[model samples]
Target: MADNSKARVRRLMPEDAAPYREIRLEALKLSSEAFGSSFEQEGSQPLDYFRETLAKTDVFGAFVEADLVGVAGFRRQAGTKQAHKGYLWGMYVRPVARGTGAGKSLVKAVLDHARERVELVQLAVVSDNEAAQRLYRSCGFVAYGHEVHSLKQGGRYYDELLMAVALTLPST
Candidate 1:
């Protein structure tokens, strides 16, 4: 949140795929403990991989003075198992842009999409990632349970807290 009034948010375009991938891989690399995958696992994914992901998902980016500073993505839960829900993923705000409402804006953009279009939004945050957990909670998410050793990399296990926000409330 460098300057709240200076940030602009828009749907991520095909042209943004490359820069998006670069920053995303950087986040995974630098904060693997807070994420499910390692940098090595996703760093090698080509720009085309991101292009394909963008093609299939609802993605948005926050720009500050024309520089991409934050990104968040929404994807539908697949199959008959959970088709009514959407998954929120790939959320990141540049270190300098955090805590200035840019993160809040990015989250609101995701929730805005889900509320009118999808029934539920689900996300997983690493147990020790307190900052992210606080952000999500402040944005209206509620945790149901913890998935122990939910993800493993580099010979260590990381726990995940499962969270969800209901986009539509039940009618009285």
Candidate 2:
């Protein structure tokens, strides 16, 4: 296992789009049920699409000695009423980087960044994904709801747990 103590997390810039796309696609292909998007959907997109996405979303990358091993993204909810909420999406860590604290670091980076702009950060995890659910709980997220048959792939349905963490302290 790699030492994630030295792992660094930072916001991805447009110049890092290539590697970002690579890892994002790898994640989609490797764990198709974990994400809403698929390799076929994002893989066909041009580099400029990822560049634009990098510019628009707060995507954080976890790097271990210069190699990006994990990534997570944050995006504020659109529209006036929903502005107080943000979504944490596309979270993935390379298999080799698992259990090295990279996933935790990536979640931390997203939550830390979301703290400044939103009151709550939310994410969805497949109900069977116990490892990811544990990671989110460790990072302060709690399950607010569950959606049955939330995702359909390969003619099968996946239930999902909706989780959220409040970034702001309660008013005293």
Candidate 3:
């Protein structure tokens, strides 16, 4: 899809799972080093898993016409101690849509949706991913610290810089 025009950003529905999977798998394929999961890992997951995840999470998609251009989402961290924090993950925008505000919109939507329930939204971006780092920064995310040797994939290791954005409590 051409990226010159503004893309529409909206909350994801159950029907959007296939497109969501397609773009997400594409992202993982193009830059395996930048991702926490590999195509081999997520590709073979049952389609139901994608559908179920899409249905349950606070996810948003950016579409150019009907083509899904980008997506971002959050999942509540599992545990009584950490349940107040939502972890942002699997964010991607097509290369063509990178600077067209798609990423920002997708992320902002997820953050807005999570704000009522979670006080913190956590994420990790590879240290070398400047575009992603800048996008996250613009959304009020701050670095908590860096984790050396945080992930291992494809016979090589990678580090993901930890980040979080605090969500203001909903006004009474």
* Whole-model alpha-carbon lDDT for candidate 1: 0.82
RMSD in angstroms between candidate 1 and the native structure over all alpha carbons: 2.8
Candidate 2 lDDT tens digits, 76-148: 9999999999999999999999888999988988888888888999999999999999999989999999999
Ranking according to TM-score, highest score first: 2, 3, 1
What tens digits encode model 1's per-residue C-alpha lDDT throughout 1-172? 2335356877787778888897788778777777666688778878888888777778888888878888888888878778779989888888888777777788888998877667899999889988888889988899988999998887999999999998883454
Q: 171, model 1: CA deviation in Å?
A: 10
What is the lDDT, from 0 to 100, of the residue 153 in candidate 1? Answer: 82
Worst 10 residues of 1 by lDDT: 1-10
In model 3, the runs with Cα more than 4 Å from the true position are 1-5
Model 3 residue 33 CA deviation (Å) reads 1.9
Per-candidate TM-score against the hidden true structure: 0.88, 0.94, 0.90
lDDT of 3 by residue, 1-172 (tens): 2224377888888777788788878988997887777899899987777888788887788888988998887788999999889988888889988788888888887888889888999999998788899889988999998988787875777788899999887888
Let me know the TM-score candidate 2 reaches against the reference structure.
0.94
Look at candidate 3 and tell me the lDDT of residue 102.
84
Instruction: Identify the candidate with maximal lDDT.
Output: 2
